[model samples]
Structures are given as C-alpha cells and as structure tokens.
Target: MASNGVEKVGVLIVGSGPTGLGAATRLNQLGHPNWLLVDKEADAGGLACTDVTPEGFLFDMGGHVIFSHYQYFDDLLDTAVGQGDAAWNTLERVSYVWLKDRWVAYPFQNNISALDKEDQIKCLAGVVDAKVANAVAQGKPKNFDEWIMRVMGPGIADLFMRPYNFKVWAVPTTMMQCDWLGERVATVDVDRAIANVINNKEDAGWGPNAVFRFPLEGGTGGIWKKVAKLLPPERQRYGCQLAGLDKDKQVATFADGRQVAYDALISTIPLDITLRWLGQSEWADGLQHSSSHIIGFGIRGRCPHGLKCWLYFPEDNCPFYRVTVFSHYAKKNCPADGTKLPTLCKADGSGPDSSEAAEGPYWSLMFEVSESNYKPVAQQPTKLGGSAVAAQGTWPAVVAETLAGALATQLMQPGDEVVSVYHRRLEHGYPTPSLGRDGVLKQALPWLRKHNIWSRGRFGSYKYEVANQDHSLMLGVECVDNILFGTQELTLEHPNIVNPRKNLEMKYTREPVMPGLLASAKPMSAQEN
Candidate 1:
C-alpha cells in the first residue's frame, strides 16, 4: 500500500471498455463524483480497437457491426461521435457463405440452394426429422450439440453449424451448453429451406444485422476513443495495468507501483486474470479460455469478389471462421486513389522469387481464427530483424492454410498480391459457454461481492449473451446505477430481459442527458458507515 493513508474512491473501475465507461458515465450523470477508471491499453476500446497498416489501411481487431438494443447505448455513441450522418456510413449487410464452391445467401441453414442435390436432400431430410422430434419432445436439449441436432438435424449440422461453430468456438459443439443460443443462432425454417432447394432459389434478407453502420473516420476504435473523451479526464487512467489486489485492504496495485484503495472495485478484466490478481488460485485454476489470431491483409486493386461479407472454409483448409471485406467499410481504410504498390507475397507467404516493388489502389480483408488446447495452432518460421519479407515458418500453418482456403473458396485469385499484413494473438477472445462456466461465475461473483468487488463485462462476468458493444455499455451503466442507488443491473443478472428495447426514451439528444432525476446523487463512500 502507498503512504497516502488509505486514499478512497467511491468506486474504482478496472477497464475502459464499453462496460467500464458506461459505469463511469452513469456515475457522472448521477452526480456521485468520487470514482476512477483504468485500462491496460494506452487508449480506450478493448477488443473494439482498430489497427492501421504502414500502407494506410485500417482494420478493426475483428469485423464489428453496430446494432443497439438499448437507448442509453445509442445515446452514448451519438454523444461521442455527434448525431449526424457524416460520422457514419450506413449500408445494408451483404453477407454470404462460400460453400460447395459457390456463394450461398447467408444463414447457411436457409440457403440450401447453394449446395449440391445430394447435400440438399441430406439437409432437408435432417430438418424434417428434427421438426418431427421437436414436435414430439417435451424436454430441453442436454447440450449444444443435442440442441443443434434436435433443431437442425444431423445433415445440416454435419454440413454447416457443427463445423462453422467449431471453427469459431475452438471447441466441439458437444462441449458447450445450449442456453447461450437464444437469438445468436438462427433456427432453420424447414419449409422455406426445402422450398428454396426444390426451386433452386436463393433465400435473401435473413437474420439480425441486416443493415449496420461503420464509423467514417477513426474506425470502430474511434467510437470508444470519443466516448472516453466525454468523461471527466481527472477520473480516468490509461496504460495502467493492474498487478494485484488486496481484498481485505480494499486496494489495487498497479504495475507502476502505485496503489489505490476504494470502497468498491468494478473490474472488467478477464475473470481468470482477476482471480489470479486477487490470489484466488483455486478459483482461477478452473477458468479456461480460447485464444484468437486476427489477421489482416492489404492488397492492391479493386475487390476481386463482389460480396461485401461472407463465411468460408467448412473443409478445415484453414483456421479462420470468417473473413470480412474490411475495405468495404470505408475507402479511407485503404490508400487514396492512384497510389501504386506492388504485391509483396502470396497469402501463403510465398513470393514472385524476386525482390521487387509493385504499384496503386488497394483493398483489405480481415480474418479471425480460434485456438485452444483442443485445437492447437501450428507454428510458423519468422525472418530475423523485422524485414517486410523474410523466410517463413509453419508455426502459424493456419496462415498458409488460410491463404490456400481463401483461394480454394474463390475469396482471392491464385496470383493476388498481398501489400500489407497484420497479425495478433489475443489470449481471451470469445467467452466460451462451457459446461462449468456459469457455475464458476455463480460462485465467484458473490465471493467477490463480499469484498466490494464487482466483476463484469464480456469476460468479466463470462456471459456471452450480453457481451456485444451495446449490451456491454449497458452492463457498466447498470452496475453504476446499482452502486450509486439501489437500481437493478438488469443486463448483468438477466441478459434476455435486457436484450430488446429496455429504455429507448433515455437515448442521447442535443440536451445534456442525465440519469433519472430520482437517482441518488450522494457518493456511496461518503455515506458508508
């Protein structure tokens, strides 16, 4: 502990992501001013951060689309970016699946026309069987696999859901639970699927996020970077990593050797990391997570494919689950017109066998792959000393595999020139809905609360249902409401309850938005006995 004699804050937040910022914003709105927020990164926006290549192409960590279920979330974003069309580019989602060597309209389950006659027959048979079983069954599915089999049947499951989900989750469908599937997974309409296959018709306009907006200037990271600016600067800390926490002392130690004590600590760090910080070895030992490798490639010329977004690789030719036409989000994401650049290498890291500079207009794509103990990523060689082109290794065999898969799926031509590349491995990417996750959280949350610590966020609470940007922001806002007043944090305890339009009336407007007038204004620490 520092020699400041127990300096206290009403609340201390451990992350600057949407959730943490939401809490801070709500506390500020309520006028309970004694609080502080910290993040490990140099700026705000956790997974939402955007990266820029040397060639001037911009890509988000992953493709993130904006769709809000909460008015408060909408209000906060609008306030951050200003309520104008100039800050955003709204486009209808043009997404598809590269299956059977062709483009199939999205919600792969509904686009059987894209598959061959045999695959179509298998899928319809399974769908019919699942419908019959569901109509007769009176109990719930035992696991995610069973739920998928019961709803989509073995044929569709074998074709799309099983393989695609395994690629995304880095775990077999049997290992996951079924409860998190609400609204996230699209259920196949048996009649429509069969009709489309019969008539060789492509199904269109399916699922959520049919249309979404992207930030025009700063990329996805710009949104949160802007939101962080709205908060009182004195209360926010960036680039300070939490080294440890003393629950009994109500203190959090930073990597820089500074210590801060608080009446309550709201942590948005990964729960396992939080446990290790608190020295709860036993609890931390039980938590597990899958890592993710995000790869971005900048290429010259207009997009070879007309599709805006699509899912690829059901045959395991590569490691990625999805690839996005990142350049489609914004032209500024690439170089300005007439600028020339050469193809450095092939997607597999192979070259033209000559040291040459290529030239001009460029486009980019982003891909995400999951990794874990069950699905280990192969290693790849690296050139010494940061050379743009060097001898390659196979540790990231997935990289080469992905390159091959992209070509096999027709995402890129065999000779497509790769101008710029970006790759990063995130330790905790998607929160897995494992069999023991909910139980671990159930025990861990109350245990932490006994020490005045509130762990919440995508990995904070480990709930995937409410883990998107809108839900995440609301989680923080609601947590503040609970801490400052006695308001319920609906997004935290009940995800489905808060999923659809909870408080649209509170959305941001030109007038300064504040929480409810009756919301408590007294600082929690000041009032604590």
Candidate 2:
C-alpha cells in the first residue's frame, strides 16, 4: 500500500472477470508494470465463474463454452491451462430445441422439417413469403421482430423465434434492435427450407459454435482462475469494491477508504452503474439488461441425455429457456458414482420413498431462466447449496417448478432421485441490445474517453454481439493497447469484423513487431505518477 493510502498507477482496472484479467495480462505481456487490477468478488471469473454444491456438484453461472475467434485468446488459455485433452474436453456440439413435445434440431429455422406435416407446411410457406418480400423490401429491419419477419416470415416467427427470444431476453422482440444479430442468429434459407422439408433432412450446423471446448475440471471458472495466476499477484487485488470515481481528478475511491489515482482508468463495471456513480444517471435509461436465474440439480443415476450437450425450451411448459446436461460435459462435474447421498425429493417434488443415504452414479442438469421488468420472475429467497432448508415460494419452490418442467419436457422421470439442488441469481445477466442502445453508447463512450476513462466489458460497452468471453477479454486487451499506443480497438469498434473470422493481428508472446500500433504515437506514460 502506498503512503497516505493514496496509490498512484498508470491504469486502474475494476472487475477481475475475463475483461479485467485480459487487460492486466496484456499490460504485463507488454512489460508495463505500473498498473493495478481489482475485483469486488473474492475470486476472478465474474459471471463466468462456477459454483459447487455441498454434495460435490459443479455448475457454471450460465452456459459458457469457449469458441474462440481470436488466436490471442486461444493462445492465452492454452498457456494458462495446457492444451489438448489433458486440459480441456473438445466436444462436438449436439444441441436441440424442445418444442411441441419433440426435439427439433438446432438452428430451428434451418430444421423446420422436424415439425409435423401441417406445421412444416406453415413454416415452408412463411419462408417462401419472406424470400419474396425480402427481394423487394423497402429498408432494413426496424427492430428484432421486423428482422425475424423479414428473414423467417410470420409462421416461423410466430411459432419459435418470437416466443423463444421473449423467454431468453425477458423483453419483447419489438423493443429490441437488430444490428447486433450479425452471426449470433441464423437466417432461414428459402430454398434450403423447402429442400429440407421435401427430403426430410436436418440442417443442424449453422453458426460459429459448431464445436467447442470445456475445461476438464473446475468448470468454466477454472480457466479464468488459471489465467489470473499468470498475472503478478501483487498487482491484483480481490474483494475490493469501488465506492465512487472522480473522473476529472483521475482517481477512484474504494469502500475501504483506499484511493488510487491513475493517469488512465480502464473500468469493466457496468456502464449504467458507472454513469450513476459519475452522477449522470439520465443517460442510463437507454441501457437495458435482463437478470438470470440459474438452477441446477444433481441426481443419482446414470446419464440419460447421452451426447446431448444442451436443449432449448420455448413453450410455457417450462420456466427456463434452456437446460444443459452438465455432467455430460465432464464426469468430474458430479460426485463419485459410489458416493453415498440421500434424496431431497422425487422429480415431481414429492417426498422420497426412503430418505436413507445410498451410493450410486450421478448426473446433473443446469437450467437458465431469464427475468426483467417486462418479464417478471418469481422472487424468493435464493438457495445457496448443501442441505439448506427452503420452503414454498423460496428456492425449493423454484426448484420444484424446474423439476416439473423437466418432467413435462421428458428430460426427467417422475421418481428420479435429486441428490443436490443449486440456485443463483445474477442481477446483470445479459446486456440487451435495445432500440436506443447505439445512440446512447455513441455519446457516453466518447464522453468517458474525454475524461481519461475507458469503459469496456460485457456491460461496460453494452454490445451483446461482442459480449462473449473471448470478446469481453479482448475488450480489455484492446483497451490497454489503445491507451498506451493509440492502436485501433477492433473488438470494441469493429465487432462484426472480429466476430466473423479469426483475429491474428495480435499475439500472446511479444515476437515479431506488429504494425498499426505506432510507438511514437504512444500517449500516456506508465511512470508518470
């Protein structure tokens, strides 16, 4: 600690998630020592972290699979936690959408052939109409709903796109924008839809995450914990909350009364919260976000959903929009097969025939439910883990609802034994792309930059298109380069460019000199303070 409890550094990074860690890693790799990293959480990996139940079951905050679009990100993870089968499990994506009581192949627009005869006719006709309308369309889609209609027509939109998205975003499609749908969504092909329906073929592969990797152990958070290890521990501070920011003075005050003055501040905090701290809460109205309710169940039995990594839910039969076979990702996700455990409840949420502990195999399911002002969720006391008591309308009620949903979706049996239950609610889950998002960001980001502050991260920049783990990390890395050398931040500025293809411009190791980042144009001095 500096004397007078006022430390000075070139850059002060807030939040130790992927983005903050990425910024720190880049600064260190470039040999910049006068910087500090702090996070409110006791550990790194913000929303990407994982939680384990007392019965020995691990669950990530949400579905986080690494599908890297940058070689730098790929290399960082490889260096942090070795490469190949030893450190990761490379799995082919086998995803589906559970609707109409049947499993539809993923990229539902491309696989409408899985529907019944009448439904197939309805969807095929819509695709044909959309293609015809698109050929002579007047202007681009005004909102997400318009885009869905233009690409998928009314039948597909009415059946799946609208309902599924409403459940996922917890907001009406009409209230959201469409520019962020670069590669995140799959557009329907009129001819392909027709051909698939005629031949009864399934078009499963469409988007970027066709094949992805998961850490062999410790879940998704394990990867970041290892990445944080690569940085100097003395420079990293965990469990430090930012009380307020003095942008004009270039100083940050912590809740503990510790203050740090920086030449340039790189903040990964949510843009809305940052604005509020800066006393500019008026600009935050344009920013919209949805909350997430993650529920997990550890059951004693052999895995039933074989090779089925994840499945989506669209109907009212379930509360969650998606569920992942967590144990299928890795065996270590569950307790040892022989480990003894008593049943909490049957899949129907009824009392078990016997409460005696028994040894057996184990499997787990993780579910995600979205919530927002537009879509309110049942608020109740959250269940932490491990034999915690929960009554109706609390964690137990939520779990009961989820189990009933599973049974309704045929993912669970009525008498299945649930050994462990876990539930956690993330206040800031997904950064929504609202209709007025771009307008607000255009002003707020530049305004922050003028104050020597760089707001970049999942919620910092608030660009859902580039808010993935890899993109979030690069936001930090690119911000550091921009601050030091005036280098263009591609991931932040040109998400469409960096997202569609591999970004090989930067490397992990300082090897061949890279162009475009002019040293003479370097702005801030790391040793200024």
Candidate 3:
C-alpha cells in the first residue's frame, strides 16, 4: 500500500451499469455529493451495450425493449431522453414463433394452428387433461416444470414451452423453482387456447412487452450513456477496473493501483466477482451463470421479412433461442441508405468471391445463444487453439438453415445478401437461478454487509426478476436511498414489491433531496433492508 493519503468518500459505487448509475443519480438527487462512481468499461450500460461492426452495422446484445412497470423508472427514462415522441419510436411488439414451418403468433402455446394436425390434437388433449388435473390438485407447483405442466399441460409443454425455456435458460425446467415466475412467463388459459386452436384465431399481442418504446439513436446503450452525462463529471470514473477490496478497512482497490476508502460501498459488479475480490471464495463458488454469445448479421437491401420480431430454433437448427430484427428498432443502426459495402463472407464463411461493392439500404438481425455445460455451442475453429472460430455443426452449417428457418418461419429470403457479421461472448451474461442461488445469496450478502458493502445488480444480487435495465437502475437508486435516507431499498431486498409501483415521488419541477450525515462516522441510514 503506497500511501496516496486516505481519500475518503461517503459512498463508492462499483460497476457503472444502469444500477451503479442509478445509485449515483439517486445520491445526487438526495443531495449527497460526497460519492464516487466507477466502471471497468469506457462507458456505462453493462449488458445493454451496442456493438458496431466494421461495415457500420449496429446490434444490441439481444432483444432489449423498454417496458417499465414503475413510474420512477418511467420518469428517469423521460428525463434521460426528454418527454417527447421524437426521441423514441413507440412500436407494438409484432412478435411470432417459428413452429412446424409456419409463423405462429407468439405466446405460442395459445396458437396451435401453426403446428401439425397431430400436434394440435395432442396439445389440446394435454391441455384438457391438465385442466382436469388442476381442478382436483392442491397447493402450488414444487418446480418450474411442474408449474408449466400444470398451466400448459403436456402437449404444449412438450412442443414449445419446455424446449424453448430450456434453450433460453440453458438449464432444465425441473431445476428451477416456480416462485420467480411472476410476469415473466406467459401462461395460456386452457379454454381460450383450445378455442383459438379450434377456430384458428391468432393470439398475437400478449405478455408484458406487447408494446414498447425504442430510442431513436444509439440503441439501448445510448439511453444510459445519456443518463451518465446528466451527473457531475468529477464524481464519476469510467474505464477503471476494480481489482480487490480490503473489507475490514472499507477500501476498494482498482487495477490502476489506486485505492479509495469509503464509509459505505455499493457494488453492482457480479456477486461472484465481488466475493472473489473480497477473498470470500466459499460463497463465490455457490453462484452459477450461463454465458451468452450474441451474434449479429447485417444484410444488404430492405428487410425481406414483414414481421418486426420473431423467436426461432426450438428444433436445434441453431444454438440461438431468439433472434431480433435489430435494424427495425432504428434505421440509423445500419449504414445510411445507398451506402455500398462488400460481403465479408457467408454465415458459413463460404460464398461467391465478390470484391464488388453493393449498394442501398440494409437491415440486421441479432441472435442470442446460451451456453453452459449442459448445452454447449457447436461451431468451427477458425485456427488451431484460437477463440475466433465458429462452432462446428452449428446453425451456420446447414445451407438453408438461415433462409429456410427464415422463410419457412418467415424472417428473410433465399437470396438476402449478408453484408456484415458480429459475435461476442459474455461470460457472465445471465445469472442462473439454480437451486443453490437463494442459499448462497442469503449467506454472501449479509457477510458483505457486515463489512459495509452492498452487492447488487443483475448478477450482483443474482435476481432475474429485477435484472432488466429499469430494475437494475432502481436497485442502485434504492441502495443509495437506503444508505443516504431511510427510504426502502425495494428493488434490492424485494423484487416483486418494487415491480408494481414507483418507489419515489416523481416531481419534475422540484429539486431532488440530498443525503444527510450520521454519527459514528458512518453515512446516516446504514440499516439494511
């Protein structure tokens, strides 16, 4: 420890994602100016970053649409972009599922018309059986699989829900508990589902994000980037990696060899990473995560598929669970109209050798592939012992896999010129809600708190319910509020509690409140929720 003199602050925030930014903003709002924020990245927006290909095509990590259930979140977004239609595009989420060679209106369990006649009958029969069984059963489902079967029956579960969920979560449904299924899963009504199947009526607009707003520029990351600018520059630090922590000393050390002592630390970094930094290895081992590979493809010409968004690959033509038409969110996401670019290569790295430049408007699609020990990626090696290789036997292998899966399910055509490609692997992409999650958090969080540290965020707290952009931000905001004032840290302690309403008063005209100091040299309001 080369004594740089003790630089103490009221609060020190790690990981400047939405959560960290939220905390800083809230601390500023609460009139607490003695706080510092830092992130490892050059900018904010953790998993919400936008990637730009060499060809000038942009793609978000996956499908990120803004649909807030809290007024506080809404107010922050309005403040970030200013209250106007010009800053955003309010689009009804036109979504679908690709099943049995047809486009089925999403919440696929409700639309059996897309399946074969045999599948349809099997699904209906299962639905009826499930209804009958449910009418006589008592108590709640013990696991997610059981709850899914109870709600959707065997037919729909077998055909869609089970496989699709496994693909998304990269874990078996039986391994997860049912308690986390609030508004996340789409539960289909048996009677309505059967009726719709019988009448062949489509159930299109369903679920939380039936309609959402997208920022006009910079994608989702742009929102938080703008939000970061709203704060006083001196108090924030970006592009700084957190190295370790001296828990007893209440000091956080960064990779640059700088150490900062704090009265209280609000860490939004991954819980496991934080544990490792604090040398708490036992608790770190308990947490689990599924890595995600975000793949983006920019193609020449207008979008061939009429549909705005769709979820595909239940049958394993590809490793991806969902693919978003990223260009649909904003035209500026791709190069301007009439800009010419040459095809890098095909999805399989094979095609006609063309150095000739192509012209006109472009569109892009983003695909998400979940990876874990259970479901590994199948790509080809680019070279010996190199990470740049695509997996072998993956979806890119089959010739018509892309277009057929596209047209047979309706996303694109046979001759859509692919202009650009992008692929990035996020090691801790999603916090897996395994059986051991709750127990680990219970022990780990309190232990850290005893040392004056609060670990929170998507993977930090390891609660998926409050892992979205808005929820993560509120987690930070609430943590600061709890630290500065006696306000409840709703998102951190209770996710469901905060999801239904705004946690704070949203008065735009008035100045925000500030934090007050306390005795014992601790920041006031240090009680944990």
Query: Which residue pairs collide, candidate 2?
Result: none
The better-scoring model by lDDT among 2 and 3 is 2
- State, as a TM-score between 0 and 1, how close model 1 is to the true structure: 0.91
lDDT of 1 by residue, 241-351 (tens): 989899998998889887889999999999988887777767777676788888877886789766476455565765688899988887788888677665567654567
Which tens-of-lDDT digit does each residue in 158-209 have in candidate 3?
Answer: 8888888888888998988777776777777877987887788888777667
Best lDDT among the predictions, by candidate number: 2
Candidate 3 ranges beyond 4 A from true positions: 1-4, 346-349, 383-410, 500-529
Model 1: worst 10 consecutive residues (lDDT sum): 520-529
Please give me the total number of clashing residue pairs in predicted model 3: 14
Task: Please write out the lDDT profile of model 2 over residues 68-99, one tens digit for every residue.
Answer: 77666787898888889999999988999998
Which stretches of candidate 2 lie above 4 Å from their native place?
1-4, 381-396, 501-529
Q: How many residue pairs collide in each prediction?
A: 18, 0, 14
Candidate 1: clashing residue pairs, number: 18
Instruction: Tell me the lDDT of candidate 1.
Output: 0.77
